[model samples]
Target: MKLYIVRHGQTEWNVEKRMQGWGDSPLTQTGIRDAGLLRERIKEVPFDEAWASPLKRAEQTADILVPDQQIHVHEGLKEMRLGSMEGKRQEDLHPSEKKTWQTFWEDPERFQPNGGETYGEVEKRVNGFLEDISRTSSGNVLLVTHTVVIKLLINRFEDRPLRRIWEPPYVHETCLTIVDWDGTNGKIEVSCSIDHTKAGRGW
Candidate 1:
């Protein structure tokens, strides 16, 4: 099976640099334009199935990317719940909390916010969702999800440890990452591509 994974477009919270886990903000104009550009880039893929997080931002992006297809909303694809940190800017965190937050990203399996879901929890749900998709779908699949979820998915496919969650190969907004999975194994074809969002006259 071939998978096309896309991180949702930019939101008001994204521009403001706020924590948006479980919370939501509408897409910016640039976000819509990027989604449109992404649509054009992947229009010829002929996806047989599509799935997206229940969040509106991801749902909206999926709709734009796969106009006529029915996108199944999966709770497992939702962003990590940030608990008390939701809607707060990184600068707003207390000095101690900020240090822990930074550590949480670097070593998610060991640290987490007071009320947030742990990395292991998110991994379990996402892995279950992937297993179901692999079992039920036979052709190309498109998934529109959050940044952290995309990161976790890539980490799993690449056999990287959870401690390196914040490592290189970032997942950019509306960027495409392709993976080819054959039941027990998967290969990354494209990591993250922003070629559709070039600054030329006609991108």
Candidate 2:
């Protein structure tokens, strides 16, 4: 089976560099355009199943990218909950909170927000989802989700340590990542592709 994973397009919080976590934000106009462009880029791939995080940004992107397809809303695919940090810019964090935030990226399994989820917790849920999908789905599948979820999924696919998950290259808005899964084994085909975002007549 082939999995096509996508990070949702830029949202208002994304533009402001604010922590979005489980909080919701509408997509910016550029975000909508980017989603449309991404749709064109992968339209040739016949997606047999579609899934998305329940968050509006992800759901909206999935709707645009795979219209007429029933997208399964999976709570496990939602972005990591940032607790009190949601909607706050990095500079806006309190000194103590800032330290925690920094530690989170460096060692997510050990550091998490006061009431938020650890990276380990996120990995469990996402891995569970992947296992379920691999057991039941075939052909190509499209998963529209958030940045954190995308990173975690890729880390698991690559068998990388959870602590070093954040070290991977950043996932751009509406960027696509593809992986081939055969029940017990998986390999990444495309990491993050932004070719559709290029402005040209030949795109």
Candidate 3:
């Protein structure tokens, strides 16, 4: 099956480099425009089913991209809960914040901030959603979500360390990740994919 993993456009939190942490932040004006452009670009492809995170940013993007279609709101697709760090800029975080972020990479299983959910906690839920979707034989599926969740999902399909998967932050508004997962049913072996950020077609 063809999986289209897309990151939602810029939100106010995104521009501020704040950790949205499952918070419901409205999309920025730029975000709305980006979602609309994505609509026109993706309308050409025959999307069979739509899946989205329940967050407003992701839902808004999904709605603009695939209106009139009933969205399967998957709770497992949510961004990791930041607890105390929600809406706070990384720059404003305590010195321990950097250490915490680094610790998350070293060991996701037990790392946690004041009230932040560990990466391991997020993984379990995200994996459940992915397993459910992979059961399907064939269809075009789209997941509009936050940056951290996007990286986490990619890591699930491709065996890589969480920190490595999150090493890059070049994803712009309306970026698309084309992932190919076989229906063999157990684990996915990724063959090829593209980052449309560099595509110079005014997308």
Candidate 4:
């Protein structure tokens, strides 16, 4: 089965550089427009099923991308819950909290958040979601989720270690990633591609 995975568009928290895990926010106008741009880019792909995180940002993107399809919300696809950091801006984190936040990006394997989750926890849910879908679905499938979830999905597909999860090619807003899953394994057909975005046009 072919999976078309897309990161949800930019949100108010995104603009503020806040930790958006589990917390909710409305999509910016740019977010909606870019999703529409992507909808045009992949308008012809025949998607057999559609899934998205229950978060409003992801749900909105799914609706824009596949207006005619039924988007099944999956709890397993939700963003990593960054407990205490949930809505806190990057620059505003306290001194000691800042160190842990830096660890989250630099040495993810050693990151022990005050209340946030470890990468391993998010991986478990991602694995469950993939297994459930692979066992029950076929043909093309569309999934809309957050950056961390999408990155974890890539880590699963490539079998990368936790330390290397934050590799290059960041998942931009509404970026499209295509993968081919043959029940047991998944091969990436495309990484994070933002060809449909305004910034991608060399502006």
Candidate 5:
């Protein structure tokens, strides 16, 4: 089966540079337009199933991209929980919080959020979701999710260490990552491609 893992479109939090993990935000007009462009790009592919994160941003993107389909909302597809960091900008974080945020980008394995989930934890849950789909579905599957979730899935597919999760080619809004799953393993066909949108690179 082919997995079309897509990050949700740009949101209010994205423009504000705020921590949006597990937080909710409405999509910007550009975001909706980008998703529409992507929809036109991939409308020919017959998706057997559609899945999405429970977050409103992801759900909205899914709705815009596949309005004819019923999206199966799954908690495991949600973004990494950011706890107290949600809805706050990095500059607004306390000194210690700022340090943790830095660690998250520089040394992810050692980084710990105030009350958020660890990378390993997010990996496990997202992997479980993958396992469920691999067993129950076939053909093309669309998964609308967040940046962190997309990165973790890529790490799992590439078998990369948690420390290297923040590698290059950052996941931009509404970017598509295609994976060919052979029941157990996934091979990436495309990684963070936003050819359908006019948005700049980086998340």
Candidate 6:
């Protein structure tokens, strides 16, 4: 199974650089247009199935790309629940809090910010989602999700420092990542890509 992943398009919180953990927001007109262009790019991979976060930002993008595709919305695929920090600007936190945030970035397994969901919590749900998909699904699949979740997914197949995984790449609007999952041998190959954007002249 080639699991394709993508981040939702530009949003208001994204523009403001606010923590959009679970705070819901819709896509901008630019986001919608860019997503429409991605619909063309998605044709490159004839995905057999799709999964997405329940959030409108993600679901909307998935819907646009695969209009007739009824994707299963998985709570496990939701963004990290930010708790008290939801919607808070990066500057509002104190020096110590900021330091803790840094620590979390360094090693997510050992760090947990105040009023923040630990990476362990995220791992549980994410792993569960993948497990179910592996046991029951077939053919290539798409997952329309967030940056952090995509980072967690990558960590599953690669051996990298937590800090690097924590600092995920710039997942430009509609960017796609392909992950091959073979349940028979328990092997997976992950690759980050911007081909969708380049092919569609979305850059």
Each candidate: RMSD: 1.5, 1.6, 3.4, 1.5, 2.4, 2.5
What lDDT would each prediction earn against the true structure?
Answer: 0.88, 0.88, 0.72, 0.90, 0.90, 0.77
Error of 3 at 111 (Å): 3.5
Worst 10-residue lDDT window, candidate 5: 194-203
Model 1 C-alpha lDDT per residue in residues 1-203, reported as the tens digit of each score? 99899999999999999999899999999888899999998988999999999999999999999999999999889998888888999989878769768877666777777688888888889988988887799789999999889889888888999988788788889988999998667899998888898842265
Candidate 2 deviant stretches above 4 angstroms: 199-203
lDDT of 4 by residue, 127-193 (tens): 8898899779999999999888999888888988888889976999999999998977889999999
TM-score of 2: 0.95
lDDT of 6: 0.77
Error of 1 at 149 (Å): 1.1
Q: What is the total number of backbone clashes in candidate 1?
A: 0
User: What is the lDDT, from 0 to 100, of the residue 103 in candidate 5?
Assistant: 86
Per-residue lDDT, model 6, residue 148, is 76
| Residue 12 in model 6: lDDT | 77
All candidates: TM-score:
0.95, 0.95, 0.82, 0.95, 0.96, 0.86
Q: Name the lDDT value of residue 73 in candidate 5.
A: 93
Error of 3 at 3 (Å): 0.8
In model 5, what is the error at residue 8, expressed in angstroms?
0.3
Which is superior by TM-score, 2 or 3? Answer: 2
Taking the candidates one at a time, how many backbone clashes does each contain? 0, 0, 0, 0, 0, 0
Candidate 5 stretches greater than 4 Å from native: 199-203
89: Cα error in model 1, Å = 0.4
Off by over 4 Å in 1: 199-203
